[model samples]
Target: MEQQNWSLATYCVAPHVAGTATLQGARLTDFGGLSVPIHTSSTYKVDSAEQGAVLASRKGWPELRKDGSTAKDEFFYSRWRNPTVAAVAAHLAALERAEGCLLFGTGMAAISTSVLSAVKAGDHIISQSSVYGGTFHLFSHYLRESFAVQVTFVNIEDLNTLERYIRPNTKVIYVESPSNPTLRLVNLEHIASIGKKHNILTIIDSTLATPINQQPLTLGIDVVVHSATKFLSGHSDLTAGAVLSNSQDFLKQVLFLQQTLGSTLSPFDAFLLARGLKTLHLRVSHQNNAALKIAHFLDTHPKVKVVHYPGLSSHKDFHLAQRQMSNGCGGLLSFELLGGREDGRKVIEHLQVINLAVSLGSVESLVEQAATMTHSQLNKEDLSEAGIDESLIRLSVGIENVDDLIEDLRQALEYV
Candidate 1:
């Protein structure tokens, strides 16, 4: 028999042959006509008892096996693995250049699952001090209280600081580069080297950078996590998260937890995320350009006390960012209003074009008071320690007209 050339559309159309390779690249089309029609199916039909046995076995059909085995039987249920989700996961894995990828209901689900799967009770975790508010709470409170997991928050900029915080029991080092709200950049290669020295697993939240801007795994980091809710799903229409790892063993463990914890993403959401990823390169590049322009504008503004963006030369991590990220800094940036908390509030209230919102990474510009909105859970001292000021406003630059965005910011800052 003549061999046939296989494409994403080919595998997607015949989902039963849902090979892991199917998700490796941009397979779906903007139009509905493609290799695979939306497998809007919750369940599939079983052909025979022997076929069912094969599906339940460790080995499956050529389409389901990583080795491409022709042995029939693999997929039993959607929860364990759906063709749609598998296709998306495979594509994401390729994007991050990792061994495999696992999807989750939300960004937090991905973070928590990776942490929980990698670290056990009594294991220490070293993380960046300035992280997302929800993640901060998860590490500081939930993990500590429930699992007796210990976490040390270190200043990622100072290698000595992070080194001193690492304990003998440390199993993993977690960090968020260009950290939430503050835009603090962490050194991926340096940290990965440190983790390798101690045989510790390193995981990074690359949601802000997206694969288009940065690939932490390539820097020697063991694992990479993303809240696809932000830039990956640029329209903010879907909430999803993903974990990509280079180790098959580690990927199995994380996938096992995902199955047991029941935090898997829905097929529909998976489809949306797959679609969102197709344009990721274009979207992130546009946002990076706009953010750099806006950051420079804010840096020179008289009413702005300070601008926290890696693209800005004055930023402490500008050089590091330039070395690590391929594209540019990122769309998210923060600026401290000169007039303090009141000024921050005024800027938000006065904005007409930019929406006053909490979440970011959308097509429309959004502005918010970080201390009051996103990082409100942090106490005054913690906020100060994280470089979050009472007057700080976080900006998620959109693909809007730069002139219009600047005009909006100009008027908003004028309120101060």
Candidate 2:
């Protein structure tokens, strides 16, 4: 979709990739448009029964395979794939430096499908304790309760202990870096090496880090999943998810499950996702710089007890984060208040420039208390196990002027 030689920073802004996809198979050949056209058609026209049969049976991208035989790149139904969605998938694959990519209607769909594709009933999984609430619920409730799959949640800080959780049936090592709310760091290379040594598949939800900050696949991880609703769609106007991998076999499995589940992304949302990716590096870089400044500001404030951003020296994982994440730690940070949940609530409500919202990684700043908001699905005991504090306030810094963001935070702290 794009020039392979260009650096990642230049590739993010270059318009060649999106333009090429839009030009191919375009009905308005003379329109000379630069944007990707939404293929609203539910099914594609096939020349004959023979052609239709061949297209319907194919599982993954043709060019990625090593075999000499050629596989046609044709879609028969929207449930299987759409041209607009495929375009975005291709774009994401390029950004993530993967052999193939698949899109889903939601982040949970991507996570669930990715995990399910790896193992079945009687299988075991080792996951990080501090993960997105939806993922925790999936492994704890849906996968374990429904399928009888075994799961062990462990603190990823101590890499030495990961091997102890593995069993003969263990098939997957699942983790999230710069973990939600807590801003904890996981050594991607260390986990990937462990998975490789034990013949286990490693999957990471790189939503917070994005590809600009961290590409787990490049670090030897098996699969990378994303909630494109956040940083990938920086405007917060669309909801989508992606699964990417250098392993064609793994991607093919995800593709089959996505087709079976009918969790395809819409053409319009796909267009938005493609557009969002063009400026990903730019948006993330600005957010990264601004967030580091804000983290410093919050660290010094008396009302704030602790800041949980990897960028800060006070953070236990600062040195580790420097080795794992490039560009910047991330736009998200969490901090505690001396007065507990009440002060956290007041700070969120008092902020003017920053919105009091649940989601993160957008053009505007957002603040939410993790105890009652994002991780509320977990009970009190679960919260304690996950190390989430009631006073923890999560902040998602945006592209706003660093001074303005600091000033708004200053006033909010004063009010609290």
- Highest-lDDT candidate: 2
Instruction: Work out the TM-score per prediction.
Output: 0.90, 0.91
Local accuracy of candidate 1 as per-residue lDDT tens digits, 1-416: 99765544334323432223233343444354533235566666778977777766635523322221111134567766777677677666666666667889999999999999998889899888889999999999998999999988875566545777778899989999879988988888988999999899999999999877788999999999999889888887899999988787787788778878989889888878877776676777788999999998999999999999999889898888889988788889999977999988999999999999988888888889988998899999889777789999999998999889999999888877
252-337 per-residue lDDT for model 2 (tens digits): 78888888889889989988887777677778888889899989988998888989999999898899888889778989999999
CA error at residue 416 for candidate 2, angstroms: 3.0
lDDT of each: 0.80, 0.82
Question: Which pairs of residues collide in model 2?
Answer: none
What lDDT does candidate 2 reach at residue 125?
96
Query: Model 1 compared with the native: what TM-score?
Result: 0.90
Kindly report which residue pairs in candidate 1 clash with one another.
9-35, 12-36, 13-36, 23-90, 23-91, 55-74
